[model samples]
Target: MAAKKKIRSPELEEGHLCYICGKEIHGDHVYIKTRRRSELHIHFECMPGKQQVN
Candidate 1:
């Protein structure tokens, strides 16, 4: 069976770090699951173009 993919909601609290740049996400960030199924929090700008919020 294939693994289920999902886009997790952003953390509303302050002090969450970006997965790519490691900088603090200011507001309205997003979290994506990698191939390994690990969750990573990242800023919208830091996310790759191939990844889109539905």
Candidate 2:
């Protein structure tokens, strides 16, 4: 059987923008997450990005 990787503890910090939309977000409502351990990425809209011109 293949080896399993261990997940480290959750790391969070303020001003952590989303990797998707580059929006500013907090660990509160509409936070960021991932199934794998990459970067604590979030949505661009979730951080601080350009709003819709609508």
Candidate 3:
């Protein structure tokens, strides 16, 4: 049996670049920890299939 790598979230900085748009995150954004154990930052507007809640 093989062990699965655990995903972890790293601290996000204000000037961190967005993984999706490749732009600097200055305001609203989200961070995701990939299966490869890498942290990806993305802006809300740039997020794919993003929907607004009432």
Candidate 4:
């Protein structure tokens, strides 16, 4: 059997533009920001993954 892929968020489901490189990724992507306290909108490489290291 083939593995099922994760679904993207609704905000980016249709399509998302990256802030850093202006890249576009479809499903199973991630969204990230340089600063945690940043109020500015950021969406680089389409989106970021759920895996976070702190």
Candidate 5:
């Protein structure tokens, strides 16, 4: 079976920006590591439709 991407919800920092909306993550957020090992910081509300971690 194929491996799944690593998804985690970490504490949001003061200047963390959302990868989707390009705005600062104010409240809660998620962190994901892609197959290519790229780290993405995304907002909870702006997460991709099919890739909601929570």
Candidate 6:
């Protein structure tokens, strides 16, 4: 079986920008690591088709 890559959600900072909205993250947010090993941040509400996870 192939191993899954770990996903990390770093704490919001003063200058962090959302990947989708391109605005500073002031509240709840999420993040993703690209294939090139770079991190992208996004606001929670900006995620399309978002669903609540149990």
| Tens-digit lDDT string for candidate 6 (1-54) | 999997665652456888898988876678799999999889988898897879
Candidates in order have lDDT scores of 0.80, 0.59, 0.81, 0.52, 0.79, 0.81
Task: Name the candidate, 2 or 4, with the larger TM-score value.
Answer: 2
Encode model 5's per-residue lDDT on 1-54: one tens digit a residue: 999997665653356878988998766789899999998989878766756556
Q: Evaluate model 3: give its TM-score.
A: 0.61
Ranking by lDDT: 3, 6, 1, 5, 2, 4
Candidate 4 TM-score, C-alpha based: 0.28
Put down candidate 1 lDDT per residue, 17-38, tens digits, no spaces. Answer: 8989999877698978899998
- Candidate 4 stretches with Cα past 4 Å from truth are 1-13, 32-54
The Cα error of candidate 2 at residue 53, in Å, is 24
How many Å off is the CA of 36 in candidate 3? 1.0
Residue 40's lDDT in candidate 3: 90
True-vs-predicted CA distance for residue 35, candidate 3, Å: 1.4
Each candidate structure's TM-score, on Cα atoms with residue i matched to residue i, is: 0.51, 0.31, 0.61, 0.28, 0.55, 0.57
**Stretches > 4 Å off in candidate 2:** 1-12, 29-38, 43-54
lDDT of 3 by residue, 1-54 (tens): 999997656553346898977877886689899999999988888888887878
> Per-residue lDDT of 2-54 in model 2, one digit per residue for the tens?
99998765563456666666666665534545677555666545455657777
RMSD of 4: 13.5
- C-alpha root-mean-square deviation, candidate 5: 12.1
Better of 4 and 6 by TM-score: 6
- Model 1 vs truth, CA RMSD: 11.3
| Residue 34 alpha-carbon offset, candidate 4, angstroms | 9.3
- Clashing residue pairs, backbone N/CA/C < 3 A, model 5: none
CA lDDT of 8 in candidate 5? 62
Candidate 4 lDDT trough over 10 residues, lowest sum: 38-47
lDDT of 4 by residue, 1-54 (tens): 999999878786557555556666455444445566642233433234635569
